[model samples]
Target: MTSPAIPFVASSSYPVRAGNRVRPLIDGEPAFRRICQAIEMARESVQVTVTFMWAAFEMPDGRGSTLDVLDRAAARGVDVRLVFWRPDAETERHRRNAFWGSAAHVGLLEARRSAVKIRWDRAHPGFCQHQKSWLIDAGADGETAFVGGINLNPHSMVAPGHHGEGHNHDVYVELAGPSTVDVHHNFVQRWNEASERLAPDGRWGAGSETDLPFPTRIPAPCGGATVQVQRTIHAGRYCDGTAAPGGHAFDVARGERSVFDQYRAAIDAARRSIYIENQYLDVPDIVDCLHRALERGVDVVLLMPAEPDVTLPVSPERRAVLDSRARLGAFANFMLAGLAGLGADRRRKPVYVHDKLMLIDDAWATVGSCNLHRYSLFGNGEMNVSFAEPDTVRALRCELLHEHLGRDTAGLDDRAALELFRRIAKENRTKRDAEDPAWQGLAFELDAATHVG
Candidate 1:
């Protein structure tokens, strides 16, 4: 663990909020289950910022579908509002993964008479509105929020143990405290300026969609954690003259890049170890930061997808990762790894690690939708909350390690635990190569030098 004196990285868009409670909910089944229960119990409002949502996705245990949950909340006089991404020509290639308000979707909403208010937002050309969050009972005494990288697709909605075919491994953090005020503020900003708000068939539950007010007061302290909400907003995205709770008012015309800034700062301040699980680890600046950390004797583990969606041949993603490998593979203390699972056809399969989570020195950690890629770090809309709570951070690291290594690492220090992770991952890779199905866990080490290729 880091010294107790080490503080959380500062943020330009939000202030560090103390006395907040944060819980790490691993995997989609656990995350969505809690989010659904919160929606069902919501009495004031259910607000969601969706980036990618498959139309056929549903809540576990027959709770309901995404729209069904919103409809049920609305049917009970609870306000339900959703801001969904609407891809433009540049982002049209992502439309298949997003529930953009197309003619078919508009017709479905009209036919279902969905009472949920909806707004569509278009990102800057070639960028995306990639935030995935759920804020329940906004501004109420019991307000809570869910933030992470989980998407609404069957491939991402699997159980925590990962049965059947390989599924997307992801994480979501549930938060309730003064920090949640920032989430409420972000939703209001996006909802008020959603593109196509005035277009025909642009909004569902028309005549009912109303602009939201910024939260005037912070929620009371709920726990001991100190939290700071961070974001990546493209320049000129939101011009609202509002500020996050306890934060100075920025024009926001210049945008906010606090997520990227925090990541760099955390890696630079590492005293013992840095554990990060992200979809892609191809950001040049981040790779450089990790290189510096490893040079300073800080053990680092970067867990990414065995089969990254970003690394399509001849794609820009491919070039970026190859560049990262060339720079970071020189450090012996740095281990690059990926996860795999048993497929339904009784074959080894790569499970996409869609988690955007990082733990530094077992004292600071962050969880949200911001990837370590240019799109998420600079252009796309993103959200993450960093917390300085030793117990919470250490517990989350242990939980994730157990899931990946199938062993309890709670007794080990952060550095020792990650060293064990490297050994086990390499062992698992050997077993996989031998076509053995008896590997301890889903993790396996990847050759940083040629993994991208």
Candidate 2:
């Protein structure tokens, strides 16, 4: 059956673009390999928006560190551009493993004699510039872009088919098509209006802080998948009045919440099942939508952190949402689970689920850095590309589910696949409780009541 054409995040700054190709890179090692390869092949530029970067992150197969990767690209005159988050006083405490443009970081760049240009951007004073993206060969025929929640740290650089100590499970989608122009536009917008660009210590590299012109020509289509680039921009963050290629000028003074809007729309539009993997799910309205979907008999599965930080109730909304998830235990159509890694020693360790993506009805999906939380949906500089092509969406679903279930779900329908996921996860949970290492896969269902309570 052909899926209905649903309007995807209509309020985005960029229009829906067709003839695109998307490939999901499931774990950090593979993702970095692909990203580094693109950088090595970059002819025009390599633009990266960084949130958290550690000095420990190195490229695959002796390619050197993260900085080394960018530096090598710059040495080849590929125009490497990096935008690092500049946390203010309020956000400084949370700057863990981040290359937040500190003086020491700058000195390291100087000491290494690196040629990579750097710009430091801040989010709405107290929030975050939590966008992790890459644009390779921007505007060129082989243009490409990548978006996801993967961070540059050792905890994220583990091999796939996890079986080891605690690691971060994440994803990134490689994009090629007309839509790659939007990524180029996003980088230019942020680079030009970087909050600290004028500060004495705001930027690095001589004559590298110059503003970029908005793209005037859209890249030709590359495939059949349709995509819409969406974002969550804070009001008054960028008042430069810039816009993407072939899109309306953004209402920068008013802000945009297309990620939040798209989450609601996608959940509400689900007909078969909704598969979500996000680091956190503390948004009340989103939980309400999930509850309603379960009531409608739509299979719903959410994979998140095994032990997320729980703060004392600060707002009534916070308490209400947690209570709502606790109530999800009563819904038979819902499954709440966490990912785990089994060691060769037959030990179980929770693999932090840091992926922020959703596949709905095996026909639509979104992959990017937008978490199902207020920070990402409301304030952070988040970006996602929502696509509505069954072939592309289903391929991603099969790949991800096969990794988690150790079984091919391609033969099963969406609903049946989710039911199998629930059964296997429940079995894994019981095995975990019995201290047995024999389980079908790494996913193990959790008691929503206890996990959320």
Q: Each candidate: what lDDT?
A: 0.86, 0.86
TM-score of 1: 0.96
Write the residue-wise lDDT of candidate 2 on 73-147 in tens digits.
Answer: 889788888899988898887677788877788889989998988988899977889889999988888999999
> Could you estimate the TM-score for every candidate?
0.96, 0.97
> Clashing residue pairs, candidate 1?
none
Which candidate tops lDDT? 2
Q: RMSD, each candidate, Å?
A: 1.8, 1.5
Task: For model 2, give the 10-residue run with minimal summed lDDT.
Answer: 306-315
Query: Candidate 1: minimum summed lDDT over ten consecutive residues — where?
Result: 1-10
lDDT of 1 by residue, 292-344 (tens): 88888999999988877753344686576567666676777778888888886
